[model samples]
Target: MRITNNMMTTASVRNINKNMERLSKAQEQVSTQSKIQQPSDDPVVASRAIRYRSYVARVEQYQKNVDNVTSWQEVTDSALSDLSDVMQQLKELVVQGSSDTLSDSDLAAIKEDVTQLQQTAIDTLNTSYGGRYVFGGYATDEEPYSMDADNNVLFKGQLISDFNDNGDEQAIKANIGYGTSVTVNVEGQDVTGMGSGNLFDTFAKVLDGLDSGDVSELSDTLDAIESNTDTILAAQADLGARMNYVSMVGKRLDNDYTTYKELMSNNEDVDMAEASAESATASTVYEASLSVGVKVMSKSLLDYLA
Candidate 1:
């Protein structure tokens, strides 16, 4: 094995280039504040980061679903509350008209009041949320209830008298979690006599009773009025349950968001303290290698002869 100047110089240059490369990588890690600048630097960490980021993205999407569901529920709750209040007012007016102590004019005024309340109920059932009807069920773009020129109540374009054919309809829902969804609406038919007493029909009875001076007829409406109120209460209860479920899912999503983010950080994010230390060590080694290479190259065979 002959010791040649070419071999010594070649080995020293290679060592110096290797140290420079190490320094460049360490400095880049520090500057970028990332564990790896490219996936090729660390495939395992890159794969894990991808999975964690995807988890974060999914959590965000489900969170948006939860938010939209919450908005829908809030709108539904408001409409139902107003509807309940209308029922209460109708009951009070019915009780007032139940007494025969009133004059003809008083009965007439009561009839007017009943008519206005009936219209109000009709309007309430047609309520919309975010440009979509709250009670519209599957047909959110259209009103649940409407009134024709004859003051005949209509539900989904069918006469109220005939709308009961649909019976009970399922509420619309939004998925807020994996395998979990929240119902955000109460069917409008439930208030208009589908599986419940017809509120408009009850209003008609009240008006008729006042028109005929029939105190007994108005008294008979207490049962119908009570039934309508119970229906509203039940709808409110169901909405509340859905809201609770959404809240629980939202909390879980929040937790998942935090967890996925932490995992991503652990997998991909750089540690400033450690990265800085590594950069400094690599820099020092590179400088030392350059010094040694200069010394080794300075004393080549030609330089010794000079």
Candidate 2:
């Protein structure tokens, strides 16, 4: 078939348009730093980016939970440490008051000191973090430890020693990872143990022994005080273990966050160097096609004027 000027011009114009489209696409990729402008450009890359972004979002939420739980544990640990210190003072008072060489007034003074220290311990057990009591189990809104009219220590309105006798104490758990959690609250019963009416009751006996000037009874109550200290230490140890585990989970989550973010970037981001080269190549082809299109249109105004 014979080639006509009109047909050549049409074909040249069509080819130039296609080249211009390619140039625009390459330039857009370079400028936007993305492999595709829309999902329709590469469905697989778009889908993978979505999934990876979702994974990153979930990891972020897990990280937030970890941070919150870590803070809770830290506050709880600090409170327990304070209580231990108070107990140490109580022990010193008991040791001093147990001696028979002291006068009645001296014994009375020691008894007063012990009473103040016991109240301090109770206040420590009622410690709150973020306006929620750390030792109240699920009853975080209320103070866990209190003294009744009879000097009996009550945990959430129940006798401290009898609080968990029926095994009804609930733990406060926090999710640090997928399907993984750690207990954050140290229960009041765990702090005082199940001996007699609890630590405060033992303190009451110590006070009574002091009041009546009975050195033997005051000396015997030292064992109960020691037991209370042991129980508090055990609770602290358990809390420490949970804190360590949460730290590990947090580290893993940080790794996961970085991994997911990199994966998403790889799926959607364009290589700037490659895209720039492709854009240059496409621009060269488009310009060449445009020049050829102009030449193909042989019948111009110049021909008419001639």
Candidate 3:
């Protein structure tokens, strides 16, 4: 069988084309720093990379939720701390006001301090952070308290506010009690029991008695103020526990985020050493193919005569 010039030329052209294709593919792989440039290169690895990316995205979203939760916890803690301090000051005022030996003038002087303490409580309740009322829950734009002309307190917002971390309520545990679900803002009256004649209720009465010169009410005022202090302390304790819970959840979220990042790296990140080896192998194969093609093409028409 004779190998004609036209056939030799065609064969050489085919080998050169094949080598060029290999060279292009190797260069692409080197530039991309990936063994799998396209899905066709390694369909399984590509699919795994997709899943890993999705996992990383979800982890990032959870991280954002953790941030919000942490912020909420901080606000809760601040409010509770302020409330505790207010209770202590009110207790002192009640003690000073209870002295029967003091003149009406002395009691009247102490009443001013009580009024200031009450005003401070109001201010703390209406506290805002980042332009939003911290205790307002979802009513971020609204103040949680409003004072009447008669010095009475009214809750201006909801009792319970909703805070969700990661779109999953289970991820968050802001609410601690098992009572009626309050609105966005927990009313001072609701927590301290104003109508039920709790400690806070007695404190209000004591403040009124100071102006009325009702010396007999001073003893009861002291009792109520002390009791109310205890109640506020308990609520503050609950807030502290909730803060701890948020901290724990945040830690778990951070660990999960780290794990997800590592998984994503394993799935999609290139192995530099392995990629370089593969590129070198591809180069050698491509060069060998070119050499073989050149030798075959050099035979020419004389080789056919022999």
User: Could you tell me every candidate's TM-score relative to the true structure?
Assistant: 0.89, 0.88, 0.75
Candidate 1, 1-306: lDDT as tens digits: 997878888999999999999999999999899998889999999899889989999899999999898888888788889989999999999899989799999999988988999888888888887898888778988877888897777788877667754455667868787877767777876655553247777777788899998999989999999998998888788788988888889999999999889989988989999999999999999999999899888885678788
Q: Using alpha carbons, what is the TM-score of model 1?
A: 0.89
Error of 2 at 155 (Å): 0.9
Candidate closest to the true structure, highest TM-score: 1
Flag the better candidate by lDDT, 2 or 3: 2
Q: After best superposition, candidate 3 residue 162: deviation in angstroms? A: 24
- For candidate 3, the TM-score is 0.75
lDDT of 3 by residue, 1-306 (tens): 996767877987887788778778767767876657788888888998888788777667655655665675576557767877887877777677766777878887888887787778778877775677765445568876666676566555222222112232212223322221112233344335434455435657878888776767766676666676677677667656655765666677677778878877776667777767767877888788788878877775577789
Greater-lDDT candidate between 1 and 2? 2
Give the 10-residue window scoring lowest on summed lDDT in candidate 3: 157-166
Cα error, residue 236 of model 3, in Å, equals 3.0
Evaluated at residue 204, the lDDT of candidate 3 is 73
lDDT of 2 at 94: 79
Candidate 3 residue pairs that clash: 158-183, 158-184, 158-185, 159-183, 159-184, 159-185, 160-182, 160-183, 160-184
Q: Judging by TM-score, tell me the better candidate of 1 and 2.
A: 1
* Residue-by-residue lDDT tens digits, candidate 2, 1-306: 997767888899899889999999999998999998889999999889889988998999999999999999999899889988887888788788878799988997998888888889889889899999988888999998898998877888987666654767589887778899888788877887765747787888888998998888888888888888888889999999999999999999999999988998888988888988999999999999988888777677677689
Q: TM-score: which is higher, 2 or 3?
A: 2
